[model samples]
Target: MLKIRLKKKCKKLCHAVIAGICISGSLLTTSLLAAELGYPEKEELTFGFIKLTDMAPIAIAYEKGFFEDEGLYVTIEAQANWKVLLDGVIDGRLDGAHMLAGQPIAATIGYGTKAEIITPFSMDLNGNAITVSNEIWAQMKGNIPKQADGKPVHPIKADALKPVVEKYLDAGKPFNMGMVFPVSTHNYELRYWLAAGNIHPGFYAPHKGDTSGKINAQALLSVTPPPQMPATMEAGTIYGYCVGEPWNQQAVFKGIGVPVVTDYEIWKNNPEKVFGITKAFSEKYPNTTIRLTRALIRAAKWLDENDNANRPEAVKILSQSNYVGADREVIANSMTGTFEYEKGDKRAVPDFNVFFRYNATYPYYSDAIWYLTQMRRWGQISEDKPDSWYKDVAAKVYRPDIYMAAAQSLVADKLLLKSDFADLVDEDGYREPQKHFIDNIVYDGTAPNDYINKFKIGLKAGDKL
Candidate 1:
């Protein structure tokens, strides 16, 4: 009896061990699949953003539960200014933030602050405009030609404003203008417009310790926060300013200024803000990085899906006090596919705030190169660099590899169609040559040196301050 009982117990133990092994194998395969789908290593995240309509993606992701769908609990906070937002990301207080397209490139190249910040997402395109105070607008109106309907010709050029700037110079009054930041798209676009009309915006000489970009300026450009633009112009502190919406729209609503030219007119579909994070953050939390990017991509698609049918709802969310905090009417003026240049001059600018269409979310290396070219043009680089150097910096800062991985995962999950990302599958990370500047200067990003030399005003090869 004892022998028979012991034999029965051993048989039962053997069967139990076999069952355990089979379950372990099944779990191991499941874990591998989960890894392939990019399970988030860190779920709780805090992101920062400035109060601008271009920050709609971050807002939409949180409001729409896209982040929650990816197992990410996200908190979106508004920073006081761009500098604070950038510092929060650099110091790890915030995981990432909506950053000026130039911030990561400038930071990586040791322009303002030295940090290895990288962006896998370009937030939006063509959401900025140059606004001049009412007084200045009245001075420039006579120079601008009228259309058949008595409206000023669309894309009122800087040529109309040039004579006014010359008058300021002749009278020994400094013609001051406001850009949100030094390394901002507003600065470069404002400068490009001014230079195209034969007005010298100025140059920066950081090598000579003169970082004030007013070396030989015809119109002096200075920094002013976005929210303060209208008030500053109202106070007569600045004659004109270039900034992202709804600030420009706010100016029109308040009757303080008139938006002269949109950045879309300056350079059609130019890359704007980017979602930026530190390299260390990305390396330490690789899965989280891709997951967050995936969430943003989904949000961008939703924003632009159905020909922007969702934009009215998006504008309402952005108008909340916790987000952009502007009035709904003010925000909608630009967010809803139409921009009110003058208070009553509402025009259908359907592409004013592009989120996902035209591959606006892709972090193309050529976009990085374009910002670098502008940096060199304005004397921030203070030296000429080889085309290879431009390419190298672009590769370091714009991580399309991460972008593609996220895109592929989304397609696999059926959240995004493969056809939705057709340009992505075989992308070389460079945009085809762009030719839509207000001055009609064709930009070929592959030849940075040659493109820099083509500029009429700006440092070319072998030129330095």
Candidate 2:
């Protein structure tokens, strides 16, 4: 099969064996791989992911044979947590992995681990939501406005949880919350939602060796892995949590919690996970880097094609133990176009798990800066930085140059349409000023420092701890 596929691919490349041979239906290699046209430099690869539905691109690429179509054999493994997954990539144990959008940026900036990690693909968007325990939601539900049918109004603000937080504060008890990781989109999104409602989610002053992020917080936020969120909240360890799909929906399945607000309502169409590789890896195996990205993009396109008609199948793939490993109905609860905020209160949220729509696969510079702005806002950056610094960091980590190369190749192969990437023609990386934040504050990535100052609870310019 490899021989036949290689023969077809080689015929297209004009007999450029390009360093690999079909010896007795097996692959043998010469060092001249990817020398001229498009053969991948490194073929056998392993990728890592967390147990979340947003890891769909990697799963789809493998299951749909997109990687095999590129003449690459791939392995997909689920790491225990984000840190282990990141460490695997930082070292060479794993070629690349699905990563938090902030992970690559934070690594490049020496926040946790220092590495020149870059992402050519942004995996998906708007797949996360915040859920509170049934007790907390019971208190919050009373404050929320109801519709004509007595169902709670959506895009529920954190303001309703303010009185609950105050009740805990008034009792001299800490109001604890869980986020996936300190630099995760969940962390920033939860912080953004909390701070918007005058509930201080606290700051991280790394200069003072405080990574706890709860210095002045009214609601103390901590890390609880995505899979453990429902159990953790149910155990009364944390009152609420912000995490990606299957978990938030898991709570509803268990009748333990209710999803209060989605990240879509917090910040619409926000960039979520990224496919990250070390800079050395890209430089050492340029063609391999691009090929994997192409597979991911192809998979992303299939996932969101025809207005997510493919989602039900994708959910089946995710429900497998090798993937998300959640119950099919539970995974489909959110992945199938409707999110149940509370049990039996399913609402149409078709955009809940966006894979390729809205150019979700594109590695936009503005998206990188938005995460950077959140880091600065929450004091993870610890010091003020100029807008130029933000731009430079974003460019260093978010490599659209590589993304465009993969996208263009797909266009030339006619697997994807040129119209699909019309935005790439004269693209300047930065997006227009985003105006749909839950707080009604506009986020202009071009002027990050100015955007930071507009926030009421966050660290502003020169406002160090």
Candidate 3:
């Protein structure tokens, strides 16, 4: 009786399997189907981010279903500060992070936390500005040439700000400035702006236990958290600050300060943030790494598609407490491509917050090299290095090969096209020497030392301030 029952059950299962296989023809390849299915290696993943508008890629990826389409279950968490966020990535608490472009380079070089962090995607470009308090703005307006509308003509050079700084100095008051972090783009951009105007933003002599960056400085620079920038300025602590939006725009809303110059004017379309992961994480889960990049790329395209028509919606989403937590109007001030200089003086500056267009998401070795060059230029490197050293360091930190693989996968999937990015056929990863700086200095990533030498101010090869 038992054998008869077993035979009957086996025959029934066999018949069902045969019918199912017949329903789906032999031409269907299960392996190819699985690849197209795009399931993530790890479904549940947490990504860490600092509270800034440039972190929009991560948020967009989650909200726009890009991550879901790729089978990535993601959670975006706001970190208290950069150090904590970087530490979270290093310790495996975060699978990856929204990071400063310099974070990977600084980490690989053993600047702050020694770990091999890699960036496959650049987040956005040109969303930062240098803002000054109301009193300082009053002083600076006298030095600047006014427009027909009584507003200062833009691309406001630090030259226009120098006189205000001097008056504070002559009054025996130290002019303090706030930046996000030591390895932050805000710090380098601020230093670049001030040095361009002949105002020394100072250097980091770590060998002498003087990381204070106030060494031989006309402006005393310090690290203030991003959200605290407006309040710090309002409290009369920092006279001015350089930071990513919407903090700069927050000052304009509060009527506390005027945003003097944008980083877009300081250096055109400068690389800002990057999506970073530990070398260990990438090596341990290579497929997961590529999958995440694909999701982010798609999200970036969605954000910038239709000429940023979606930004107002993005601003609303980011205004939620879980993300940036700033008000909608404040976030939109910069996110929507116009910035408020003085209260009710909003001007059209469409490139203020760039997400995807113009190859903004491609991690360039040249961008990494530029930050490294600035580090050496400002004594953060604390020693001399050859040009090859810069290239090697950039290669190790910025993984353009990984980026191309992800981009190609998107192209193959019909989600994106080749024309959306730079002509990568003969691409050598280095941008042609950029000459749009406020100081009019031409920067060739190929010749970092020569660029350093051109600067009248700043540390040169084999020299320390």
What is each predicted model's overall lDDT from 0 to 1? 0.89, 0.90, 0.84
- Residue range 375-421, candidate 2, lDDT tens digits: 99988998889899999999999999999989888887778999989
Task: Spell out the clash pairs found in candidate 3.
Answer: none
Question: For model 3, how does the per-residue alpha-carbon lDDT over 133-220 read when each residue is reduced to its tens digit?
Answer: 9998888888888899887888788898888889889999999999999988999999999998899988899888888888889999
What 10-residue stretch in candidate 2 is worst by lDDT? 1-10
TM-score of each: 0.93, 0.94, 0.92
Evaluate model 2: give its TM-score.
Answer: 0.94
Q: Whose TM-score is higher: candidate 1's or candidate 3's?
A: 1
For 339-379, candidate 1 gives per-residue lDDT tens digits of 89877999999999999999999999999999999999999
Clashing pairs in 1: none
- Candidate 2 collision pairs: none
Residue 375 C-alpha lDDT in model 2:
94
